[model samples]
Target: MRLEKQQITAGFIKQKTIEKGAALCGIAPIERFINAPHGFHPTDILPQCRSVIVFASPFPISTLSCNTNSPYTFVRNKMVEKTDQISFLLAVELEQEGILAVPIPCAEPYDYWDESRNHGRGILSLKHSAHLAGLGNLGKNTLLVNRTYGNMIWLGAVLVSAELEGDSIDMETLCPSGCTLCLDKCPQHALDGKTIDQKLCREKSISCTPGGGWVLSCNICRKICPANRVIKQNL
Candidate 1:
């Protein structure tokens, strides 16, 4: 009976997430995060967390093709806000149902920052959480590549006290063999196949104009990625 309740709750959560404008959603049990970095676990954020709910909204493929970076940057910021909003609404709805739920910010406003390395960590790593939830596998560019959405998605997550049934982790390899387009194309040489050099990436990827407007000056890695372009062909 307890397991049945978990199943029902999991289904409800996923359905609600999709209804809330997410393109995909999945659940991962706390056990799957056993190796999560210390202090970054679901339970670390919400002591009673028994499940992690991960969801994503597709990035506008059209924005990526624009000549100027402003369109891409504008949409990128909006996606984060939209995903975070979905997580917030989902948490509130779950809490009303007597379940304790905590929303993890999709990005920014994080406490961890290493000035020396120019690195910052989200309270919970949404990409890793999404991978554990079986939404997709991490690609060579360190981006989550979904079977349907490819790498064109923004992630968000929520922690719940319910011990929901977890999704099966995706085992299929999504990256093409010997493809190093993202690595070779990076102007900053920030990617090393398995991880990114945050410091190097930031140096070229972000900038401020003379007028003081913020611009995501570079996206060659994401734009040049073959996997990142797949979604458009399918659409």
Candidate 2:
């Protein structure tokens, strides 16, 4: 596609995302993630990838504090399902426009993890993708903290073969100066200032289904962060 035509198509994709229930949407050229770790790049998933469409579906902030057994669990689960539906629909829409697009799921891994690590690593880190897409900045807690939705948001992505313009990164830092709330709040101390111990976090936060129901066992890091204070004030 021509440069101008690609831009118009990108615009249409973004609009379609919002119309389909996403609260935020932006584009990220595959070049922006050239240095992404092995097996995590758009090209790694789809070799012909030229652009990435990342979008966010915000959830109620109140539900961040809910226990696994609480009613908010249902709401959170529904949001996750809704995000998948939106991404799938967008991919179909793009295909109808004669653009090849592949939707990256919001939850659930494409395959099993290495037994030694047992970490929950998706093909792409949605938070990092969201940052690159200019939807938000990454917080110290490893969550994408959008100015409006804070860290209480789910992200989805789509890879496209058509060339499209990417959004500039948001350089603004959402973490407060000298704040260690998230690190301190972590029950397993899974987060250091520079990185997160995903194995520890996953083990502590995720509950296996014995019967068959969703259970996010913990979210202390997300709940204690000051990044969401702006959203709180607005409410």
Candidate 3:
């Protein structure tokens, strides 16, 4: 009966997130995060967390083809904002149901920052959270590659104090064997298969216009990935 209740709660959470505009939703038990970085575990952010709810919204493929970086940057910013809002509302709704839920920020304002390496990490790594939720597998470029949406999605998550059933982890290899397009195409050589050199990536990928507007100046890794192109064909 307790297990049934957990399943029911999980179902409600997933359904509500989808209804709230999430393109996809999956849940992961806290036990699945045993390997998460010491200070970045779900329990670190919410000590009572027993499960994680991960969701995503697709990024506009049209913006990827834009000649200027403005469209891509604009869409990226909006996606972050929208995803964060969804997580926030989901948490509020769960709390009202007498369930403890904590929303993890989709981006920025994180406590971990390494100035020497120009590296930053969110309180909970949303990509890994999404992976553990069985939403997708991590690609060579270090992006979450969902089977349907590919890597063209923004992620958000909520930590819940409910031992809900977790979706099966996707063990399928999404990246084609011998594919090094992302690694070779990276202007900054920031990608090394399993990880990214944030310092190098940030220098070229992010820039400020003369007018002080921020721009996503580069995205060769994302653009050149074969997985990223799958969504276009499907559309």
Candidate 4:
């Protein structure tokens, strides 16, 4: 029956995501997702997107270092590759069993907070969505704060046609509301509590590169959050 299989799909998805390296996973309605502004606007997406299956892959803590910018700096982009691969794999598995699975692409890749656009698409505030999906809370650095998983998690979501119950997480209830360790660790001062001055962040970030205040990323805030202190997964 469709009903029985719908429930089975969740278990399959969970198994596949973890098998493919997900550290945590949850589901939410597409309606709950669009309101998030961290990366991009999902407002126009159809209601056919009945369920959103969210997942996170863990990042390494011990391997982090200044000289390790090659890996840490490219963490987001790299996570995209891994997430995309696993997503499609799940989709294929789901489809074979007559369950619908659609992998939603990650946010557009770009210098999201570019001064010219005044509209940052990629850096949408997705931590709350993550929390609402039961992934985690926002950390001191303003990143998703998973108590056991730490700050070392990359996110992905599946917009499925299959109707499923949405999960909710109380972020405020989980995290210590006023911690600022993430801010203290930020070298670029990108984070000042929950509000980030992107101009200041970009300006300081670019200074490290060869070009004058403009080049590849300098993910200082994301890389140093204390939530990563107990990270059990690597890369």
Q: Which candidate leads the pack in TM-score?
A: 3
Model 1 C-alpha lDDT per residue in residues 14-91, reported as the tens digit of each score: 998999999899999999999999988888889999999999998888887788889998998999889989999998
Model 2 RMSD to the real structure? 2.8
Q: Write down the lDDT of every candidate, Cα atoms only.
A: 0.88, 0.82, 0.90, 0.63
Give the alpha carbon lDDT tens digit for every residue of 110-217 in model 4.
435556724364432346557767787775566677777777777776656776666667545333556566677666677777667666666655445454332345
Each candidate's TM vs. the true structure? Answer: 0.95, 0.90, 0.96, 0.74
Which parts of model 2 have CA positions greater than 4 angstroms off?
A: 1-8, 65-69, 110-112, 208-214
Instruction: Give the lDDT of residue 32 in candidate 3.
Output: 92
lDDT ranking, high to low: 3, 1, 2, 4
Name the best candidate (by lDDT). Answer: 3
User: 1 or 4, which is superior by TM-score?
Assistant: 1
Alpha carbon deviation, residue 139, candidate 3 (Å) = 0.7
Q: In angstroms, how far off is 36's CA in candidate 3?
A: 0.8
Residue pairs that clash (backbone atoms under 3 angstroms), model 4? 37-124, 37-125, 38-123, 38-124, 38-125, 39-124, 137-145
Give the Cα error of residue 38 in candidate 4, in Å.
13
Off by over 4 Å in 4: 1-8, 31-43, 66-68, 74-76, 110-119, 123-126, 173-178, 184-188, 206-217, 232-235
lDDT of prediction 2: 0.82
